[model samples]
Target: MKTVQVNIVTPDGPVYEADVEMVSVRAESGELGILAGHVPMVAPLKIGAVRLKHSGSTELVAVSGGFVEVRPEKVTILAQAAETSAKVDVDRAKSAKQRAEEHLNHPNESDVRRAELALKRALNRLNVAGK
Candidate 1:
């Protein structure tokens, strides 16, 4: 089976770099899967979990928002913030989710967008961490 080199990067540092049998992520339009020999393209990614399959194991990573560049032999993810399942703090994420929920419930347009983004990020982390 052929594989593609996948590198996930964030402002902090590189999250993961490995050869993956397959990669799936949520694009702005919809979910997309990348495989080796895929045509080159770039797409904006949404806040969600990125699934990476290699060998017989699958890994999930949470991305706040970013872009994915796919080439024939490689896939690169540039995320605003990214965290692996092990790196996610469930308690912290839960707290953030609660705060965002509270803020979103209020009728304030200025903070609503930020709160919504926070909620999405927290939920994405929780989902990826299997919490």
Candidate 2:
């Protein structure tokens, strides 16, 4: 099977790097799927899960918005924040989700947007973690 090198990175550092058979992610425009020898392009990503397929299995990564750069032989995800399922802290994610929900329920108006984003991120993490 053909494979392409995929690198998921954040300002802090790289989160994942490996050769994958396919990469699926949520872009700002919509969902996208990339395979080896894919056309080169760049797209902004939304806060969601990035699904990596390789070796007949799939791995998941939670991303808090960013951009993906795709090439014929490689793909790079430059995210503001990212965490693999194995790295996600379930407790923390749940706590964040709770806090965000509380803020939304009693929205200060100013914090509404931030809280919404936080809720999305927390949900993404929990989803990726399968919890």
Candidate 3:
């Protein structure tokens, strides 16, 4: 089976670096999949989960937002922030989700959009964490 070198990085540092058989990411256009020998292209990422499949395992990472660059034998993801399931704090995510939901329900004129984004981020983390 063919594999591709996939690297996921953020401003602080590299997050995930691995050779995988396939990767699926949330792009602006929607969910997209890439495999070894994929056409070279760059796509803006959305706030969601990045799923990668290797020899016999699958890993998930929650990303705030960023861009992905795909090449014939390599793929790179530059994200604003990222969190792996093992590193996520379920309680914190749940709290954030609750706060965001409350804020959204109250409909604060100034913080509504922020709250919505926060909710999305919280949900993304929870989803990756499987909680």
- Each prediction's number of clashing residue pairs: 0, 0, 0
lDDT per residue for candidate 1 within 94-114, as digits (tens), equals: 999999999988848899999
Selected candidate, larger TM-score, 2 vs 3: 2
Model 3 per-residue lDDT tens digits across residues 21-70 = 99999999989999999999999999999999987999999999999999
Instruction: Rank all candidate structures by their lDDT, best first, as comma-separated numbers.
Output: 2, 1, 3
Each candidate: RMSD? 0.8, 0.5, 0.9
lDDT (0 to 1) per candidate: 0.96, 0.98, 0.95
Q: Considering TM-score, where higher is better, how would the candidates rank from best to worst?
A: 2, 1, 3
Model 3 CA deviation exceeding 4 Å by range: none
Model 3: weakest 10-residue lDDT segment is 80-89
**For residue 26, what is the lDDT in candidate 2?**
98
Overall local distance difference test of candidate 1: 0.96
Tens digits of lDDT, candidate 2, 6-124:
99999999999999999999999999999999999999999999999999999999999999999999999999999999999999999999999999999997999999999999999
Checking candidate 3 for backbone clashes, the offending pairs are: none
TM-scores of all candidate predictions against the true structure: 0.97, 0.99, 0.96
lDDT of 1 at 74: 97
User: Of the pair 1 and 3, which is ahead by lDDT?
Assistant: 1
